[model samples]
Target: MLPQPSGPLRLAVGGLTSITDDFAFFTYNLCDYRRTGRSDEARYARVEEVIRELVRPGTPTVGAVQELPGDDWTSAAHGLGHLASATGLHCQAFTDGTRSAAAVPGGHDCLGLGLLWSAEVDPIADTLRYISGGPLWHALVMVDLNVGGHRISAASYHAPPKAGRDRRTAEAGLVATTLRSHAGDGGEIWLGADWNSPSSRTTDGLYYDPDPTEMVTSADRQRWGDDLPEIGYRTDRTPDMIMADAGFRDAAVEYGAPWAPTTGHGPNDRNGPRRIDRILYRPAAAAPGGVA
Candidate 1:
């Protein structure tokens, strides 16, 4: 009998920043080298160019991306179609952007989430979840795939800004629950999100406080609700813990390597360079959805 294929899948997850709200505010900051993990002077003149590089050929890689811009449902679908053309990774459930855009808020001239997968990966199904009460509200994109001889469920999420950790925490919980319900018996689920939560380090290899309690404003308390874990009130609070409890491991923290800050202000800036994005996943297992 032929030996089974060996090796891990090459996956990339990131927040591309909003074309209208975020990127438009800072047009000159399109140094996409971080996402490509390469050093190139090429700027993000068009979203398709960046998408093209994120999942280049020769390697079986998939991308879970946030903030892929689409002005409406048709455009949203088109935006993903463009990525698929550039990377050769088919976009699941991609019809005209016309219909899917309406159910999701940002499709009308705003950023949206997406999944880009390699050819060997067969798309099983996909769905979306709209998150409210964050610093910014956006829909979450989830996709299930069978690749590398195993089933996988993947999702792309961008949480509210750091200004609202309480809300971010709640969003994390919802994401976790969704994964559990969909995970079924077993393959594995990797939920990648631009969590916007601070880590203990910065891109320049410097230490920083991970305290989530920097600004627990009165309004924040109301948003946090009365009952929550003690860590929820800590200065080091992050949505990772919630996902951890949901039974997933942060690939960055587990591997001890992280991509540079995809999009953020400088060290002195309020939204400084933080490796807040991550690939949260369950260990290899066998089950229905492969997400035990």
Candidate 2:
């Protein structure tokens, strides 16, 4: 179950001296370094290079990252610290959601979730919260930030890759509901995630129409069973739909690049190509031109 807010939480104020309305948000699924052939140093350097290329100087930026190399909090913090140094951003690692206690090695908690933000953003005191129960496959880290004097609720999430549609839908529902509760009416919210599912609706074949045979395999069928398609692997867009129904907008689609692929690059192309990683946001209803 998601934690409920006890009362009106006070918003943190006035720490940023160079606050700006222009905010740049990004999400990335850094595949577990242990599974790849690249050395830790090489992988870290590549990640830093990619992020630096993506970030625009002088703009407030927030990056939500998944699959950070770490089995425990100490290791994850160390990894996040390296990223912070490389990217010049403040960092925080989400506790491993796969575990009932503090983040420790030896389960599905090997890969972790994290958040990185530029100095222009101020995180509210006691606002950092994690989703408990529902046994989320990966962590969902949520925090409230004072961005240019506007209170915004932001989160980083990574949905289960091997779970069934029902499980994924439930997880998405949990995330949406929890975010809405934290944001309240007319508040802005941002979520960056690797949903491990397609963004296109089943009925819509215009955007993404990958050959199911190339994506799904016998192993997938044996694992997911009835949750998969009768012939091949297909991710029903129910998870993304849940976010849409909650009033969040897919940032890529909104920016006119709905078909841009975020995954299945290089050696990780076993599942073909997909736009699974995303940055979704809900603008404040009362804001004058709205915040993205």
Candidate 3:
């Protein structure tokens, strides 16, 4: 179930067909510890501070948030509302990723995905849609927005974690197909996701080095059998490659040469540092629209 905005003020659509100035699009995985009796206020405050520091003042921003607290609609709404108020952003939609938890053996119990946008943009009526069709570990929630007057579709996705390379690649194909269908020929599309897999374009040699102790350990092989690869976890680039083949470009890669690691800084770091989180976009300039 998706949660409705409590009370968000929206602007009437009227502006140029394309944006001349810069805007911000950010993706974050707000590790779902709050559901396990952690303090929500402290976590929300820290997240708000990080967002404020990253997003420039007066810039229209859109955020794709993964791992909201709780699996139920009520808890998801509460978390979304709290974050929206804290960041002064409008709650667009929330999709419960744990709806099929009972069906998945040993799957996570509580996980949700959400989207938030600044007041400058208005959500296109009835454009919100959730992508499904495969064994997706988390929700791939998308919505069309009228940014000033330029329309674009954005999605928040989280690929399955741990020893699911085939599943991840399959899910990536589903995502790419869905985005291409929605965007059509000229529509712009933005996707922010914690892919849980290293990029195909990674120049970093550390990711390629075989380390047996990291993600796929002896215990993991014993449990899941010998089908798992030996080259550590998240080393497979097939998932990211699927996305690249669909015409999407990685934001971090386009911004510079060396990609910065987005995860493994926490105290519970297990897989070592890697740039698993990404913001990918399919420009409209590739088709009919002149804007990118």
Candidate 4:
């Protein structure tokens, strides 16, 4: 079971997982060392140069070139080291951005939850190697910390608008499968992504309605019902359905944070189109007084 984000217990945060999607905005920390990690003019710049040389365009591949899994693991480990070296954050890159590299370069975007205290990241190889089916580099990084703890997992995915019910269901299954691998007895697990799922359902299996006490504003509630009901590819299907099936509850639903939405379409469009990009955890038992 995953922990709930409440009472100063196990805290987890997440962001849209689509590393390269413009909609999934976040500075690419992997390549953009200066922007990604802490400050150190000389060190950060040098690390950035090394990454560019390793994966440079139209130049001799100076470093080792391996399969997607190998490359991803290597990159994440390296990135984590860089973060630690710069700011002592000890941040680790979980999902493999290589999935979007071919189509979307500079992909290492993470959910802007907060600094993840800890997590367990998993990677997909076969699917990631393919180009047609979106990136397979998804993960369930277990996080710990409080409000200041910027922690989150990534489920970066973008499918054709036509992929309605079936696709959303399949995507849900994938998230469930991933959670099953890392879930604990009482910790919370977060699945962050540009699920493309309209906020029709909550991660805990409840439908979003116009109850200000239970949900966001009437306009936000209407967005779930009318606009684009079918999230992902299938009709009446969405990413929430996936998390709900996995035994996880919605943080925004169970906890009251409707005012804080995750997926904003554009810069100016602060209150832009919405998606349940950040999925929270529902522990079987609530920590007494919120103590882990």
Candidate 5:
């Protein structure tokens, strides 16, 4: 069952990647992602700080959070409770990942995609589904919302990686089809995504490696075209292109790049950051509105 936080959500979309579901997966990435990632607790603290500072006090928020934990650990419910307690706004999380106990070391009991939203967001009942069919990597969460008194449908998506370009395109197409269905039923659409590929927002405009066989000669690379295309793609297109064709605005066109790299630093110089996380939407046809 998808979460339907009790209240109203405003018209805005936000997305962030790799936030561990609570600290449940902390032990899994203690050395590699915890300490080596950001000096111990600093990474977790930063995400909390972000929610506290950016989410604010009296407005609705729609966050498409990637790398969320499954319900077995109580990540989504508790995460929503935490946000509500901190900001005085209703919050909830929705994910399609199943609840399973931890099966491997350095892994969470459950891990997948989710939507973090304030009660005002109004998620449609049973609107959560796995993209690219059942049991895939990402989930799509939808809300049939009324913003500025206009009924609309909004969605949060997390697309697969660059190597799986064609599949990601198919997933984007699925999302597009869904959005079109909503529109045909008299609803407009908005989308937020951790698209995992380059756009006009990325440091590089193109998404595909241009040449996969030469990029990384692993046995998997050799198997893309001849074998499972799901593992990777021999050819690809930028997800932004697909979203644009779907009639959503690339937020990058308005927000520009973040002032600095989003990750990898030794106290100062940042690594090559990419603008893979983004918001896309078709503005309500009647009025030009701001992200409130």
Candidate 6:
């Protein structure tokens, strides 16, 4: 059994892309949205220190992390080690690419696996079906670290809007399928992502909707066709709605507001702000973190 800590365990899901030396990209707690990718170690270290000092202690956070190696997989592992060591935060990073660590990563408490699928039409449908239709979507072989008596299995992904509406809908369907597969479950599950759904909150002056009807530009229509079914078409619309249908509760909804703002990556879109990146929890046998 894992050592059950007395403090709260907080899980954070966000985007981290290392672009160049000293220039990096971050969303959520990390500042500058963009930074010198070369100094990711320094940048992330500072961020971790701030989080540790400002936020509650013993909060295990996992974000969508990217590592590009100038050499081989070994170099990648070394890079990851540097990040964890620098921050004094033990972490496990999972990436399908050779740039990931030597050890496998998965689940809530431990390093977790990351899955990526392309939008090529021929294999897209098959890939979606396989991941969601079985235990693969909720696979949590390594997340058993928390002593909370409840396990948290999480999956993070980005939907392909440029792939067209039909393709996007199919992907959303796969998300729905995964939710169904995990329904009536005892463990906790969270799916996080920058899903460019039609009902995304509007902000600033950039009126954007993932809706095909509103996207009448010839180029956009061709890319996002009219035939595809947008699971929901209003501001309240989202893939979470599908999860709700399958018995999951919106974690943000529990607070009557979202945790962050729209476009976790792009410029802050709204004057009022909105949260597109979501955290959904499956009904659990017992509360994991203890009453939010």
Report the candidate with higher TM-score, 1 versus 2: 2
Compose the digit string of candidate 5's lDDT tens values, residues 59-151.
Answer: 455454444433323553444344345534443323354332111111222333444444444444434433322433445655554333345
The deviation in Å at residue 196 for candidate 1 is 1.2
How does model 5 score by TM-score?
Answer: 0.57
lDDT of each: 0.48, 0.61, 0.61, 0.34, 0.42, 0.35
Candidate order by TM-score, decreasing, is 2, 3, 1, 5, 6, 4
Instruction: Give the per-residue lDDT digits (tens) of candidate 3, residues 203-290.
Output: 3444331222344454222122233354433246778889989888776555443434565556665555555677788887543442
Q: How does model 2 fare in lDDT?
A: 0.61
What's the CA error at residue 195 for candidate 6, in Å?
Answer: 2.0
> Candidate 3: which stretches are off by over 4 Å?
1-21, 93-108, 132-134, 202-234, 286-292
What are the clashing pairs of model 5?
8-120, 9-120, 9-121
- Judging by lDDT, tell me the better candidate of 2 and 5: 2
The CA-based lDDT of model 4 is what? 0.34
TM-score of each: 0.62, 0.75, 0.74, 0.43, 0.57, 0.46
lDDT of 2 by residue, 182-254 (tens): 8777787888888877664332444342433334454322223344355444447778889888898765555
Q: Give the TM-score of candidate 6.
A: 0.46
Model 1 alpha-carbon miss at residue 40, Å: 18
What is the C-alpha lDDT profile of model 4 across 1-292, one tens digit per residue? 2223342111112122211111111212122333333455774555434333222232111111111121243443444444434432223323344322211212223211112221222222222211123432223222332211222232223322322434556656665665445434444434433444454454445544222212333422323333354421122445566566667655456554543444342344323444435443444335422312
